[model samples]
Structure formats: structure tokens, C-alpha cells
Target: MKFLASFLILTMLTITNSITAQNQNTATKTITVTVVNATSDTGKIGFALYTKDNFMRKPIQGKEGKIKNGKSTVVFENVPSGEYAITCYHDKNNNDRMDFSKNRMPLEDYGASNNVMAFAPPTFENAKFLLKDKNLELDIKF
Candidate 1:
């Protein structure tokens, strides 16, 4: 009888732990992004996500956002808790690089989130989110 009881207890513990882990994986928040007028009718837009520490990496790969026509809406899933920002540019030539004029000024349109607040490149603090418990929504313009 004692052996049976021990087996049952062990089974229960294993089942409970499995369920807890599954719940933890499912406990993710959704991010609602609206990329408006991302490009002119003849242009395409490229976007990227970056963590707080590595700010200089060009065209941050992975984490693909959706684009249809001139606008896009994306939901980044399974994002672990951290600081992040989104930056984008209008690639008129689809050349995978932001074209520049002779003056080094962007010949193509470029933008970032929270662009309304400043004239400088936005800091992580300006765009960071806790994303610990619920969904988030942000609107970006170019």
C-alpha cells in the first residue's frame, strides 16, 4: 500500500510540473503595431527590432514584420522580458539599403517609433516596454 501511495504521489507531481511549464510558455503578451504610410506607391519598407544593448547592428535580422501594400501590422511573439525598439526605412529601390543623397541625408524616407518626441535617434528608454502581463499597442509613422 505504501509503495502504491508513493507512486501516485510521484505521478501527481510530474503531472503538475508539466502543466505549470506549459502554462508558463503560453503566458505571453501580444504587441499591436501599426506601420502607417510606410512608403510611397513605388517604394517598399523594411523594418527591424533591436534590444537595448546592441543598438548599432544594421538591419536587425529575424523577427519579421508583416507588410501589405504600403502599410504593415505585426505581432512579435514569445518575446522574453527585455527592452526593445523598432526602426524602419523606406526602401524605394528595394535595394536593402537606405539610399542617401550626396549630402549624406537620406534620399528615402525613414522613421522610428516615438518620433514625435525628439530630433535625435530614439533611445531604448523611449521605446521600451515591460510586456510582462498584457498586450501593447504602438503606432509609427514616416
Candidate 2:
């Protein structure tokens, strides 16, 4: 009787663990970001995925995509449900970073997730979007 009870308990635990793992796996989804108005297809478009804590300072993920017909697209996969913001810039010079003029002005075309347009940099609150239970498609224009 003791052996049978232990076996049943172990089996139940195993099944519970398997179900939890499956649930965790299904909780993540994809995010597709498209830049709709790139000035020219001379170079790649650089994309950064940001969370609240790392907004503008560091990115959770970064991707670069080639521009096609004045548009560029990038996909971030397996992103768990949370709040996120996106920033992208057309890297016209292919220098792997956004160029700035002497007076702290951006030289390249750039935009944020919410299409925020301001003199200062975009804030986390202004550009944030919720990623819950579904994949997202966002179009940004510059």
C-alpha cells in the first residue's frame, strides 16, 4: 500500500509540472514592427524593444532590417505578455547608430511605438503598449 501511494503521488506531481510548463510556453507571443515611411532605402533600419526600466538607456532586444520600398519590418518572437515600447530609426549612413547634430538634434528619421512627436525624447508612458494574450502589429511613421 505504501509503494502504491508513493507512485501515485509522484505521477500526480509529474503531471502537474507538465501542465504548468505548457502554460508558461503558451504565454508568450510575437510582436511585429513596421516602419512605413523611411526616407530612402540606402541603409538598414535599427529597431529597439524597450521596457519601462530600460527605456532609451538600454533595450531588451535590438534588430536591424533592410528597407524595401520605403518600408522596413522586424519581428520580435516569444515575447511574454507585458508592457513594451519600440523605437526605430532609419540608419541612412549605415553607421549602426543614430546620428546627431551638434545641437543634440537627430539627423536620421526616427519614431516611437505610439507615433510620439515632440521636441524632447519620447517617454515610456507616451510610447508604451500592452502586450497581452495576442500578437501585435504596429506601424510607425517618420
Per-candidate RMSD vs. true structure?
Answer: 3.8, 3.2
Displacement of residue 71 (Cα, Å) in model 2 is 0.4
Candidate 1, lDDT over the whole model: 0.67
lDDT of 2 by residue, 30-131 (tens): 999999999898999999999999999889999999999999999999899899999999999999999999998999989999998898788889999999
lDDT of 1 by residue, 22-140 (tens): 88766866666667776555656666767767654753343334457777667666665445677777677767777877967678776666664464555677755555656777778
lDDT of 2: 0.93
As a TM-score, model 1 comes out at 0.67
Native-to-model Cα distance after best TM-score fit, residue 93 in candidate 2, in Å: 0.5
Candidate 1 vs. truth: CA RMSD?
3.8
Q: Model 1 — which ten-residue stretch has the worst lDDT?
A: 58-67
Once model 2 is optimally superposed onto the true structure by TM-score, how far is the C-alpha of residue 45 displaced, in angstroms? 0.6
Task: Write down the TM-score of every candidate.
Answer: 0.67, 0.84
